[model samples]
Target chain A: MMQRPPTIKDLARALNISVSTVSRALRNATDINPETRQAVLKLAKEMEYEPNFIAQSLVKKQTHIIGVVVPSIDSNYFSEALSGMTDCAIEQNYHLMICQSNENEVLENKSIRKLLSCNIDGLLISVSLQTKSDNVIKEAQKKHVPVVMFDRIIPGADCTKVIVNEYEGALKAVEHLIKKGCKRIAHIGGPKDLSVSENRKKGYLDALAKHKIPVREELIAHCKSFEEDAIGAIRKVMNAKPRPDAIFFINDLSAITAIEYIRRKGLRIPEDIKIVGFNNDKVSNVVEPALTTVMQPGYEVGKLALGVLIDEIESKSTERQLFELRTTLVTRKSSR
Target chain B: MMQRPPTIKDLARALNISVSTVSRALRNATDINPETRQAVLKLAKEMEYEPNFIAQSLVKKQTHIIGVVVPSIDSNYFSEALSGMTDCAIEQNYHLMICQSNENEVLENKSIRKLLSCNIDGLLISVSLQTKSDNVIKEAQKKHVPVVMFDRIIPGADCTKVIVNEYEGALKAVEHLIKKGCKRIAHIGGPKDLSVSENRKKGYLDALAKHKIPVREELIAHCKSFEEDAIGAIRKVMNAKPRPDAIFFINDLSAITAIEYIRRKGLRIPEDIKIVGFNNDKVSNVVEPALTTVMQPGYEVGKLALGVLIDEIESKSTERQLFELRTTLVTRKSSR
Candidate 1:
């Protein structure tokens, strides 16, 4: 039979002391006698008694829980970011309640609703691909719960944001391929609606223009970030008349998918068609010939985003902070 | 200025109706006039008013939130499992709050305390390797919360479990190598503390005995299952006399690391050293010469575990249910 956990009262009774004295000892209150506190603590440890944090939180009417909503936990980028957040949370004595939206806007809103019901002090979110309106976000803000947006976000939303230099990263990626003597460089972009796609596309176009290469509208295609969806976009570029000799993908997963497909079709990487991608995902290093890519600082972004959120929660600040993190180019065998 | 969310009282004032009538109309109570109900619903929709779930939950004295704690969210195995849980949660009108322990015992306990503070309805945990006490678990049970363990578990704990036939899977992995004419088969195992490590090792030994193959002490080694840690374990087995012709790794991450290391040493896979591993991570298929592994069916395990947890939550019986999921051996280029 399972026995009930010993409460403060139980500890008090065992020591012939008052419940308030036990509580004071547990919290290391300044007024408690050192000897009495030591005895209470030793007995409490002997009885394997852990304070009821739930009961305390109920009386306080608050919790130190931060709600986080991301597109998917399986994605390497998001997972790395979450790990960074976890590290920071541990140091700051905060707890994270994470939810995955699976890249669906409806699920994202539902997750927000659930987090709100938890009375989360603050929220960290990366909007799903299909999110259009900022109303759900507005609802959370109205409750005075600060929200921090990262990566995929609603532009102009009243929240702090973790932004990356996607434009610069894309430019460097395309220029590297261009300097490799590639005349026709195609691009595989993300969902057309995403700011990431727009910025990267602009960078790609600007790089080609700087090199005096005509932008071929037929050479660019858009796809959702999933590998399977990317294959079609890749085919669109691969089959272009005067087919592109190089490609710049928005992320590593899609780039890896293209590599798998090209190899299956008996094509040689670099010598025939060079490829580059964004997000230096761990898989980028393990793939054959490795992948050349732009590295998004996902971990740092997560850490900094959480820091901004905590500041907002503790201070009565409505002024939003826009923090920008830079991405770097990593040249690997896929481009070499 | 942000406006307060329209409440039943606001709806009542706008419609010139009683607050009780408005609440009844919103909840679709049959006693309400159909026309009045339709009017209230239409106005509610127009005003962008959503029910305050947190308020409703307070009155109900419970929540539908389930707490989940995993070793790491970044691992492919755990991420896939989390995704499976997410799907079930969406279907069942439940929410999951996930915490990552980062494989630390203290963090696991801390995360549990935080989750308990949230008044979670049920808990699903895969214990960290360093966890040595059941006292914390027993405390939660004393509060009448159902806990379900999966993948990594505390043996003989008073809880439901999602068990896979890991021994059968390991037996198949080694037997396949034996059939391939590999006499010097090595095993790279996980932390000695994990039940998974124990069961898989037992199967490896049992398989070798059945095949009349000798198990050399030098050919067996242990690691913590992280890729970096597994490198030392791999080196130990690889340096054994007449170096093993085949290796059955505890998981895919370590197997992939070995593959990378072997390739760098100018060795060919299968021909030089055949390898098989557990948990066919997605990267297993992407690696050069693709790794052969035992499929752990993470998604199914997660879905089933959550189902079991929900059942235990609703049912009064404290009877523990041990549900078993099976693993399958997937042969790929690395072992072929």
Candidate 2:
């Protein structure tokens, strides 16, 4: 037979006090008599009593568990964000249940359903690339579960969000390239449906307009957030009659792929085609020529997203909030 | 009023059947009448019934959830392993609750206790770097919770484990460097207490012995698995009377850091200091002069670890099993 850990009831029985008195004393509730509270604490320590959070959650209707859904965990951005989230979650005495959607809408919906079934107190999500519906998230909200979106989020969703200033970040990246005397700048954007992609595209167009450079439709390509897709986009851009002198990519992964492909094509970076990417992934520093990138605060975004979600969960705040973290351009050899 | 999702009891009341009968029919139990099963399935489809796993766990004494404790998530190795674990777990209809220990023993213990309180059916853990005791793990097994260790495991624990062939992989890496005309090779290893580190160190020494090179104690350095530590160790090794001609690092992170430092000292890779690292992280390819590394099969390790754990959970297998997957040397420009 397994020896069960002593519970509150056992402490109450040993202390010859009411169960409620024991519970309140254990919780250090102000109303509990000081002597009784001390005695309860002493007995609890002597018996090595550990609180049963699961059973307590059943009574209080709060699990103190947050569910996190991400497109994938294999990216440095997501992993760093998760590190920040874990730190904050643990500090707040809450546990996180993490799930990966693998960038599929169906899997994303399934993950949400599973999290809901587990009765998580709240959710922090970065919607999948293929996610087109907010119905599942709305369903969670109907059950009074607060949802906070970060990084890749559902467009126009009535929920709190934490995101980097993609528009400004892209503008700065393109401006840096322009200052380096590179015209005919090509743009490799992410999925058209994604807000970050759309905003970055706008930034590229506006930067071109600011410099009075004509927008060449043929130089712009939308990719599916994969290295292969970026390679294909790069081939198309480089094959144009008047090839682009520079490329501003949606993220570091795409830019890195473009750099490799450009090198394979026997071109020297910055001299042949300058490159700038968003998201200062660690690989950016290690890659040859050291990629120039916009530093998105992934860790800060994650910590702040959890902060907002927990605030909503505990305070029951219904007013949707949006947090936009700033990004900075990190000049490196790729753009120089 | 909030609209609660319909439960099995509600279905039973609406269908004029007992709760147990409704449950059995919904589960498609063999003994349940065919007509009743059809009726339950039809109504369940109509009402969009999703099982409350938390409530179900209370009744069935099984959560169908696996608790995973890892040192950290901000690494390519761990993320890739988690990817594989997620793939296998979802296919097996199990959800994973992941906790990051941040390489702290106290936090690792806390994570285990938290997972235990959640009533997870099984545990998959990579013991933290500072973990010196297996008391918490033993406590879980005392309650009949099956535990499986992987990657960074307890040395002599009776639990099942899955790991890569670290010794052979290190030997191959060092031997390859020697074959490339490197006479003085330095080794930058991980924490001294870690089994993988000890095994890899032995491999390094054995490789040198096989090549008839006298062991020089000054050529080896033990690091704490951080970039700063690697930098410090590299500085010490490079300052020796006769600098090492090559370095075989414990992992890619250390190797990458060494590459950066060696570059800062105006030394060209493969010309001044050839390098070989373990764990072919994505950064290995992105880095300048792309790192040559031993592929440790993190994804396969994760998949196999979960498979063995699930087997133990289902079959109550007590025989201890140690699975060591093969590692292959991937030649790249770093060593060439």
Candidate 3:
């Protein structure tokens, strides 16, 4: 038979102490004697009595639950980030409440408002590609709820941000293609509004400048972050005036789309047109020739994002900080 | 400047009524007149006074949150299922609290305990591969908390379960391979601990038996629901005296693993050995030559799983339900 979890009253009665003393001890209050606190802790641990979060939240005005707002959770990058965040949140005894905006700004705002209504202590957000304003973050800041941006960081936003070194990661991907003796390299970029999109595109151009290859306007196409759109973007690049010999996609999903599109066009990967994708997702490992791409520290970014938010929530500090996580290039046959 | 949402008092003052009257009208209490309820709803809509969930949950003894416990959320199938769940939950003004068991019963128990402590209104679960007992479900049932199981349903469990027709899906896949003139067929099954795994394996054996093809002992291997294990399982099947002409994997991740291993062994897909996988995840579309897969309706399963739990929770009904969603075959190059 399953037994009921011990309550504060039960603990107090067992230890010959007042209920208030048991509660205070569980909260690690300094008024309670260290010996008494240890005794309460020992008993609570023995009974596996996790404190009632609702009652505790009523008193402390906060819970160790952070709202994670994202665009989509089905993709490898976001899920890896979530895996990292879940890993870190479990370690810190914090709960993560995830919300997806589905690339809708109104839905993003609604998720934020709902999270606020649920009394989340902080937020870790990767803004929707369609979100063009920082009004929501500013509003959240006014309410003293800390916000941390990851992956798709917004500029001039007065909040903590955790992002991969996109400019550097992109440069390395393009440089790898250049070193592979591919001229007429094309680019397939993400939504033009996102900072990662602009930064990655800039890195592509930076690589071209460094290699003395003229930047071709017709060779670049901005596409939605869906596989279907990525295919269209790749087709646009493949059909360009010069028809680029290689392509660097903004993200791995888009890169995979480009690879598939090229294959459908009766071309071969790395032979007819070499390809490099970003965010080395699991599919990157299995994609027919194995996609050579930049591996963003997605899980690490998530961990640090939650870590920083938890620190701010506990300390009630308002200092803005940015943590830039690094990325690495994983070379495979796709870029050979 | 962003203002706080209007409260009941704001509506009471505007309409020249008492706070209790405003609250009753908002809740559609019978004591309130029909005209008053309509007026209150119109004003509440205008004021955007969405009942604060945190405050309301305290009084209603309901969180409007469903606790979803899964074995692994990082996998494509689980993530897709979660995405569908979140989409539906948000539409119904309910929040989702996700917990990953990491395929450990101990971890699954811990997550369940946490969800219960949070006063989750209902549960949507897909049992872990290592879960040997139904104690967790029994405990929740005793406490009057509703649970809905999906994908890997527990056998003989007194609870509402939403699952795909695993037996039929597997039978069709194997029969398709047989029609392709494959006499030597191998089956890479999931963990024996799961009911779905057993059913799929039984279906495979039943298909071969019907085809008058004697099942070979060396041609079957259990992968235990892991990609890495499936690789080894496929190797074992490939190394058998009479190498299997076609292989049917129970899950997509495992199927991809087997395909990669086959390629590594210098064999071509369908040309050297035909392959079939389950769960038509995005990888099924992107994987080279594309995989022939069983398209289990993950979104519909999620919706129905949560739908049943919500129905039971709201009605406080005690009837156990069994819901098995159907699966369809998505033929592609891998099997053809």
**Clashing residue pairs in candidate 2, if any?**
none
lDDT over C-alpha atoms for residue B51 of model 1: 72
Q: Give the TM-score of candidate 1.
A: 0.78
Clashes of each: 0, 0, 0
Q: Candidate 3, which CAPRI tier?
A: acceptable
lDDT per residue as tens, model 1, A187-218: 99998766878999999999999999999989
> What DockQ values do the models have?
0.28, 0.45, 0.40
Residue pairs with backbone overlap in model 1: none
Q: State which candidate, 1 or 2, has the greater TM-score.
A: 2
Query: Tens digits of per-residue lDDT for model 3 on A88-171?
Result: 887788888899998899999999988887878899999887888999887677667899998876777889888888899899
Comparing candidate 1 with candidate 3, which one achieves the higher TM-score? 3
Please, what are the lDDT tens digits per residue for candidate 1 over residues B108-192? 9988876765667899999887887877788678777889998888877989899788999999999999999999999999988
Pick the lDDT winner. Answer: 2
Instruction: Report the lDDT tens digits of candidate 2 across residue range B228-294.
Output: 4577788888887698999999988788778768877798898998999988876677566778999
Which parts of model 3 have CA positions greater than 4 angstroms off? Answer: A1-22, A28-50, A190-195, A217-225, A229-245, A253-273, B1-22, B29-52, B190-197, B221-225, B228-245, B253-273
Candidate 3, DockQ score (0 to 1): 0.40
